[model samples]
Target chain A: MKFTVQVNEGPYQHQAADSAYQFTKAVLEKGHEVFRVFFYHDGVNNATNLTTPPQDDRHVVNRWSELAKEHDLDLVVCVAAAQRRGIVDEGEAKRNSKDAENIADGFRISGLGQLIEAGIQSDRVVVFGD
Target chain B: MSEEMMDDEVVKKMAYINRRAPYGSIYALESLEVVLIGAAFDQDVSLIFADDGVFQLKKDQETAGIDMKNFSPTYRALEMYDVEKLYVSKESMTERGLSEDDLVVDVEIKTDAELADLLDDQDVIFSF
Candidate 1:
């Protein structure tokens, strides 16, 4: 089965991101294909490299990066939502004249078209949101 | 498959389920953005307004005091994008003391059971 997952809330403040990650990992373990993971609204916060948790705690951003690396996953953050929330990539930083880019590894910023395309292509679209 | 092939052959019934109020959270706005973009895909689309989401289509929304851009007018323009299937939960409207006349756009009102049947027919359901 091919699946596209959407996370619509920020980490820590809500459990949606964590649940989405767990669900994605479990789906892969079960030999199902993950077509894409789309982060929108506050969920874009999960793709920021600036996120740093205590040494004893799990790093939500890094967890996603590591999972993407292991599975060669496509982690997409909606560009419009990212820009609204200040989650800038190197290209976006340069385009918007910002001083820094905070997009974490294994993630790319794109338009909402990607989300629609995922819905069209994937067998199922699962949303973990608040 | 080639991009053109996918475009020509693939069509899905996509439903945008809105349950949030218009102003307090960003879900309503974010969902609207997705609906607008999804319009370009030429999929069978339906917009379901339930709970406080019915308020999003309320006529004469004034956001000046809140300093937010009043985007209620966009609902009326949705038809221009060929996104004309708009439905509201009958119970939600009644609970809010709103009627069809209160809305900016014309829409079909469905009971909870009917709404469930409608959603069950969708290929994809986007919850907001």
Candidate 2:
């Protein structure tokens, strides 16, 4: 089955992001296809490369990046939500005239239409939020 | 499913479930953003306001003191976008001491059981 996963909380501050990651990884391991992983609200925080956890702790942002690379996943951060939360990519930073971009690897900024499209294209839409 | 076999213009029954208050959290506003954008997809959409979410549609919201943008007016424009199916939880409204007359827009007041049946009929359920 194909699934679209939505994560609605930031990393470290809440368990929603971690749970979403684990769920995505588990489903991929079971050979289920992930149509997309949409980051909305505080979930856009998971796409920031500026995140740095303690050496002993798991790096949630990096984990998602690596997983996306391994699985060829589509990790989309909602543009409106990301703009409000200050998660910017090179294109967004340039367009907004910001000095730097902090969006991590394996993620792209997009509109909510992508979320709706995922819901239409996928077999199921699983959401992890507060 | 095969790529070529899937129709490019497939429509699905998508429901956006709002269970949070209008303020103190970003869920309600962001959920509204999704609903507005989801309108462009031409899917069968339903907006269900339950719990504190019913507060979002309360009429005459004064956000000047809170220093927040009052987006309640957008509810009234949903019909212009063809997103006219709005449902409010009757139990949630009664629990909050609110009535249908207090809302900014006209909506179908449904009981919890009726809301459950409505959700069961959706192809996708988005919770916020």
Clashing residue pairs in candidate 1 (N, C-alpha, C atoms within 3 angstroms): none
lDDT score for candidate 2 against the true structure: 0.94
Cα deviation of A17, candidate 2, in Å: 0.5
**TM-score of each candidate structure, all chains considered together:** 0.97, 0.97
- Native contact fraction of candidate 1? 0.84
The alpha-carbon lDDT assigned to residue A15 of candidate 1 equals 95
Lowest lDDT block of 10, candidate 2 chain A = A112-121
Model 2 - which docking category?
Answer: medium
- Each predicted complex: what DockQ? 0.72, 0.75
- Candidate 1 lDDT for residue B13: 95
Q: How many residue pairs in model 1 have overlapping backbones?
A: 0
